[model samples]
Structures are given as C-alpha cells and as structure tokens.
Target: MTEPRFHGPDFAALEASDPEIAGIVLDELDRQRGGLQLIASENLTSPAGLAAQGSVLTNKYAEGYPGARYYGGCEVVDRAETIAIERAKALFGADHVNVQPHSGASANLAVYAAFAQPGDSVLAMSLPHGGHLTHGATVNFSGRWFTAVPYHVRKDTELIDYDEVRELALVHRPRIIVAGATAYSRELDFAAFRAIADEVGAILWVDAAHFIGLVAGKAIPSPVPYADVVSATTHKVLRGPRGGMLMCRAEHARAVDKAVFPFGQGGPMMHTIAAKAVAFGEAQTESYARYAAQVVANARTLSTSLVDAGMRAVSGGTDTHLILFDLQHLRIDGRTAEARCAAAGITLNKNAIPFDPAPPAVASGIRVGSAAVTTQGFDAEDMNAVGSLVARAVRAEAGTADGDRELAAVKDEVTTLVARKPAYPVI
Candidate 1:
C-alpha cells in the first residue's frame, strides 16, 4: 500500500473537505456560548488545551508506557505522555500517574483490572444515593462482573453514614471499597473511608472525577494520602480534554500501568494526553485556585437562593461545585423541571435524590453545577440572579398563558445574563 496523506490542522481545511461536519462543529460551539450550561459533568476546555487536543499528535499510536511503546516513532508522543504523567503527579501529589484511559468509566474499569478478580466482592455508594454507575450499579460492567455491596446515606442528614459503611465493610469484607460520588455536594470523609478499608483489608479506591479539579485548586481536601488508587477525568471542573487518568501508590504503579494498557485499552490518545498536561499546568496557577473557590461559593449562593424560592437543597447546601435540589415540596418532578430550564435557555439534568420515590427517568431532584458558569466569570451575586431565573422557570406552570409569559421573561433574563460572559469569548 502507498503511504497515506493527511490534511493540515485548520478549520478552513475541514470546511473545504467536509463543510457539513464543520457546520455541526461550529453550531455546537454556538450552542455552548448561547445559553447557561449547568450540567455538573461539563466544562469548557481552554483554547490552548483545545489546540493541543487538535494537534498532530493525534496521528501517533503509542500502545504502551512512554519509553516502552510498542509502536515505532513514538518519541514525541512519549515526551507528551511523560509530561502529562509528571504534571498530574505534581498536581495531586501522587506517587504514580497514568495518563491513558479514554474516560472516567474506562479508568474505573482499569482499577478493577488492576486490583480485583471477577466476582470479587466490592463495596461502594449506592447509585441513586449519589454514587456513579461504575461504583456498582446493577446495569454497569462493574456490578455485573463483581459482587456489589452498597452503602447509603442517613435519611435525616442525607450524608454518608460512616457507621453504616463500617458495618457493611465488616460484614462483606470486599476486595475494594470505592469512596466518591457524582451528585454529592458535601466533602467526603476520606479518613473515615481509609479506616474502614484498613479494618476490612480492602483496597481504598477514590473516584475523584467530579471534584479532582477542586482538589487540584486546593479548594478541598485531597484523597491521595488516604486512597490506594484514585481515578479522574481531565474534563469537568479540571477544564481539559475529555479523557481519564489514574493515580496510585508506587507499589501499585506497575499494576495500574499494565491494567490501562494491554488489559483495558490499547494505543493511547496522545493528543488528549498533551491537552491534559496543558490543563494540569493551568490548574497549578493562583488564578485557577481563585476560580475553584468561586465555583464553590457560587454553588452555595445558588443553592441558598433556590431554598429561599421554596425548593430544598438535598444536603442543605453545597461545599463544592455541585448542588442537588429537591422539587418534591413544589409538587413538580425533575423531568419537568429539566424541560422547563431547557426551554428557558438553561441546561441541567434530572437526578434522583436520596430515597427518592420517583424513578430515575422522572427523578425527584435536579443536579446543578457552577464550574462552567464560574469559568465564564460568574460571581456569587451573578449566581444568585441565575438561581432566581432557574426558580422562575421551574416554578412556572405549563399549558397556561401566565406560565408562558413567566418562562418567556426568564428566558429573556437568561439570554441577558449569559451575554455578559460568553463561554468562548475569543470565538
């Protein structure tokens, strides 16, 4: 076969080759800049980071660790990957770092591969009660392949019950215990988890996908000292390319690396790794620390405003970038609230609050996040206004003239608010 030819890195070239895909890309960018993005799992990657993701490194096929790659001509990609790993280690104070897995779920899969055998008992938070699917929801691979034992929060406090965790650990004696959440708003007691894991002789794995950025910015406590291994996604509040990473103790470093490559995945995405490195460097700055602090402050203010407007915060309020709001008292459901917010130019997701009566599809609560908005330069006062807008939209009745007017007004205000700080101002 003849040597293949590749095009240069330019939007003009893409438009020239395939304007349809280019138009879709531009439209997505427009959509992002046009409205409020409140999804807890999303954030805008910086222009520099985006450039790295779109770099020529995408052509490389580095199938193994940096220096021991299976493919030839991996020298440049090796440098990028090494930089990513070192930067990540510094950012999280980790003993070893693997910048390979394609997503957070992928990283979790690797974690299982590294530490546990199929059918080994694993303990984690329950999915409907703020845990991630990989933490052992029945439908996920983790739950299907392993015996899953779950723990839940207290009904009154809506916080993780350490006593229950200890009881479960003593009974099940799982091979691994995961400590993390996707929808939880309060800080996790890593020390508590560590103690429980030690008692049970279980490996402590912390999925820091959602809050690792906060940890990197020093906005909250780090799980590095407590956890045997930690999994994270470079996106979310980390504001990098969409990919996964693993950090583990030096003793488990070899196992983690082998698990990510050959066992869990092949050829790493060198370009995304480069982008993660760029984001890691950015996260080390003072401005990013300030940004992380503002993210938490904004979420707290927004949660208080929602409570003032008659909605209830799941854990009273947030100490991080995310908040879970219960709409039960308003006699509304999460699905309806999600639709209303979307119609009013705001975007968020329906989520199940702890002990929610409604099913997952029509959840009793909605999950909101401040990372994207805070990155767009929203302060606490701006968050308060956003909270009012969200409340007005969600509380408005549908199929009524009065409700239509209310939603329209909120939509107008939302348009005005987002205009003040565009998601991608340079674009």
Candidate 2:
C-alpha cells in the first residue's frame, strides 16, 4: 500500500469559508493585472517564491538558528535556512549571512544593536535626501536610541557630497556610518564611504536594500567588500519574498545572529526563508543578470523620456533601477501628480527631492523604478511610453472636465499596454 499524498488548502474551499477575504484577494489580483506598478520599492514575486511562502513550513516554530532550534520538528526547516544562508553567501560573496530579519528595518536595527549601544552616535544620510527611515530618521529607533548625525546631498548638484560626509564624520565621530538610500538614483561611492569610515574609526554599515539585485547581477557594485555589515530587503530589486537579510564580516557574525534572534524578533518565519532560498537560487541564473541589466537600461530610458516630456530627472539621470524627478518645473506638486497618475492607471510614489522646499506630505518630486515593470517584461521602449503616460497624467488639471478626459484616455492606453504584458503569467 502507498502512503497517502497530501494536498494544500483549496482556494475554492476558502472562498466558501471566507468569501469576504477571498473576494478582496481576487480584487487585488485584478487590480495588479489591470494597472501599472511603478512604486520604486515594490516588485512581483515569482510563482515558485509564492508557493514557498505559502508552504506548510509556516506552521513550524523554529525559534533558534538552524542546527540549534529551540523547538522540535525543524530538521527540514534547518536545511531550508542553511540553503538560504549558503546561497546568499555565494551570491554576495559575504563571510556570513543572516536570513531571518522580518523586514529591512529590522535588519538595520539588528545591525545597530550588534554594533552600538544606546547613546552611541550614528552617521547616515538624511531621510528627505533619499535615505530610508531606518537609517537614522529622527522618529525611528536608530535616532531615538542612538545619536543620529545625518549627511546630505549637495544643493547645487543634488548628489551626495563626500567632502561634507567626511567633515560630518570627523566632527561627530559616529560608531557607524550607514551608506545607502531609498530614493537616491545615483550609484553610491561605497569605497569613498568605507574610506571615510576608516578615517573616522567607525563601522561602515551599508543598507543595500534597494540595489542588492543589481549588485548580485553585477549591474552595480557590491558593498560586501567595503562594509562591516550590509543589510537588505529581499522584496525590492531582489524580487523575492517580503523579508530581510544581513551579510557581514566574520567577526560580527555571532553578534549579528544574537541581535536578530533573542533581541530583535522571536521565532523565524521558515516559510519566508524557504521563499528567500528560491529567490536566491533564481537570482543566480543568467536570465536574472539580463533582467537586472534591462532594469537599469529601462530606468535610463524612462528618465530621458521624462526629461523630454518636461520633467527634470534628479542628478540629471539614473545609474541604477530608479529615477527621482522633480515636478516643480511643471508647476505641479507630488501629491497632485500622484493622484492624477493613479487615476490614469500609472502607480508611483511621491518623494521629496534634494533641497525640496515642499513638505513630505506634498513632496516636490515623484520617484519611479524599472524593477516591477521589468519583471512584467517591459523593455526600454515600453518605459518610454510609460514616461509619456506619466507626463500626460501629471500635467492634467485636477477636478476638471478636460482633466477627466485626459486621464480617461491615458488610462485606456495604460490598460491596453498592461494587458499585453501581464505581471505573473505563470499564476
């Protein structure tokens, strides 16, 4: 007699059991399929990643590291996590890897916890000038616990001023200097940052959450060799599940692991770890390298097109997967542009530009990325058309009949284009 095969939960059964949630899920699926997703931080996960995230491993409670789990029945989860660790190490060429942080913020926090005590000084990029909230934003834990000295981009060039960074680091003498950004479009000078850290006797922590995939594919430079610790989210350009990872030099491995486990979070999400393993494996492929290259090319194309259509790409143009453009030239606020573009079926986030006069709520700029669209099979040509649609939508007057007509026309075109390129054809 053969052993019985196990099957997963049926969505039809779920629909019958919880129709409201099921309907909402279906609606969201429809929404994703219908519109463009230009959010710089968002990406569509692979079908294999989706399956791993929804796997039975979610039921497991592996409280400790793989080999020394506090709970029972973790033999398989141990293997999954170990695979994730090894794959990440191979991909990034790190001395050690931690695949358990729940989000990128958590990863950064753990790094901070490992390196600095309360009241220690941290030098990082300012939030309004393209840095992430975890990187010493005033309201965040890093700022609340540690003394945060933020660096800024130059007003004239709208780019990070390494001279100023060195000046600040010398004055503050911070314990850690975080080098990375959330909305910055230019390639960071990681080697310069490392030198500053060395000069200041500070730990160089790089938050590569936005560009890890590019680094992995060699489309951009890696921070692993230059930084003491590097943190990243698996979701962004990595195109994995919504989780975080930390890679570090061998000396910090034990401290980093302790911080992530008993200090930062409880039991690890084994399901997400499984998903991360799948994504890391996928990133190792030749196709992913091509995809990463295309993501940058598409961003450059979109930036040029936006400039041609009357917007200014921040720092002139992009060197990675994102573009930050100011809307002040068009006499438009980021809020109004975001709303109008949403109406026209183009999705993106309002962002604060360098030296932005406008407040964060109604920022002076919009941030666009090529990761999601590239995942959906968009090329440079498609990006040009996307830039045109974005320009037309944002240029429309709000709450007017003419504006409504223009938005409708753009929405129809977006719908037709998006229909031709579905986000998840395997699904």
Instruction: List, in order, the clash count of every candidate structure.
Output: 0, 0
Instruction: Compute the lDDT of residue 384 as modeled in candidate 1.
Output: 88
Span of ten consecutive residues with least summed lDDT in model 2: 2-11
Candidate 2, residues 172-240, lDDT tens digits: the string is 999999999999999999999999999989999999999999998889989999999999999999999
Give the poorly placed runs of model 2, Cα more than 4 Å off.
Answer: 1-4
Per-residue C-alpha lDDT of model 1 across residues 266-355, encoded as one tens digit per residue:
999999999999999999999999999989889899999889988999979999999999999899999999998888889999999999
- Which stretches in model 1 have alpha-carbon errors above 4 Å? 1-8
TM-score versus the correct structure, for each prediction: 0.97, 0.98
Candidate 1: which pairs clash? none
Give, for candidate 1, the lowest lDDT window spanning 10 residues.
2-11
